[model samples]
Target: MTDTPSPLTYAPPALAAREDLLAAVRFDAAGLVACIAQQHDTGEVLMMAWMNREAVAETLATGRVCYYSRSRKGLWRKGETSGQLQHLVELRLDCDGDTLLALVDQLGVACHTGRRNCFYRAIRDDALTTIADPLMDPAALYGDAHKGHSHG
Candidate 1:
């Protein structure tokens, strides 16, 4: 029989690149990175927030969606308070591997201001315009002087 090359002798570079990319992720001193929220179906960018490794792990594990709240300095489960939860569909890293794109199956409004997205304002003719209206009232959702609120 003719000599054949062994399959184990070849390895894809993509595998090695992914490993390196994972290793090089820079977390802040508090071990948090900014994560961008996106609508899975419409591809609309909702908002951006911080997340720690624990948040990432927990999100992947539970698939209910979680984030690191910089204001409260703790994990925030989406929809726990406002009833506007985001179900995790997939998580993606940017080309440089520093940024994160969270594709989610969002339920109800995604913005605290009652809008469908945080980016409700649009720029036109060098002026800002309100493109969308809030779906829910903040006062009704969070109440007055909303403090120490947890979605979980």
Candidate 2:
């Protein structure tokens, strides 16, 4: 990231268009790769999802983060249905190119359950414990469209 006002990476748009970026990525046979979203300021992991080449391109083109939903078999713009959007701060590829780390300015709740993040549970003394609580009512955000999603 540069000292630019925008959170986008400091790279030429022309370079981002080249196929080398997507070509270098190693998508699985299912044409999907893991994408982890993190808060740019606090380094808090928001959530983990999958993305395809199109999703990557869209995110790079627009400052908004996008992901591929295996369930929908289509592009899943981070907070399209909900208002909690994630604007891309920076995109990083792991050394192996198998995973992605997305630094973003998370708006509102990052988790669909209205929590700040998805990892709300932890193993403490051999027991599953909730470390956080929902900040908002999930039904108000998702409209009950995606309930019972096992974040575990």
Candidate 3:
């Protein structure tokens, strides 16, 4: 006997209106937007990064994350240096359509200093408190800090 199909089955949209979404955002002359990376599960603000047009496209296309590195003046793939990669979950735009919020599934730590999030320091009574410790050594990720610095 042939079995009947389930009624709960659903299909995806015909096509994602990615371009329309992009057009809604306001990018600067650098073709970049201020992207805020947030932890999906915890709602914790991990870090703030920049995303150029190419970086935004790459992040959405690959599902792996991408950012515009101001210091490098190029694209930056998270975890390439520190192994603290962020996997894109969802991308959100603020009500004003100016800012971007990236909901991500992060691996290992998020901060370069090895902390779970970059916002480890909290201000209490006008005093800063080290609420969290580094998960990995900074030197292991970015090399020696005392060395010559280069800006992008």
Best by TM-score: 2
User: Which has the higher TM-score value, candidate number 1 or candidate number 2?
Assistant: 2
**Residue 105 C-alpha lDDT in model 2:** 89
User: lDDT for every model?
Assistant: 0.72, 0.82, 0.74
In candidate 2, the residue pairs with backbone N, CA or C atoms under 3 Å apart (3 or more residues apart, or in different chains) clash, namely none
Model 1: lDDT of residue 122: 86
Give the per-residue lDDT digits (tens) of candidate 2, residues 44-93. 99999999999988887787888998877789898888888899877878
Model 1: residues >4 Å from true position, as ranges? 1-24, 145-152
Best-to-worst order by TM-score is: 2, 3, 1
Question: Which stretches in model 3 have alpha-carbon errors above 4 Å?
Answer: 1-16, 144-152
Clashes of each: 3, 0, 2
On lDDT, the candidate that comes out on top is 2
Error of 1 at 91 (Å): 0.9
Candidate 3 weakest lDDT stretch, 10 residues: 4-13
| Candidate 3 residue-wise lDDT, 44-117, digit = tens | 88888888888877776766678888877898888876677888777778887778898788888777766888
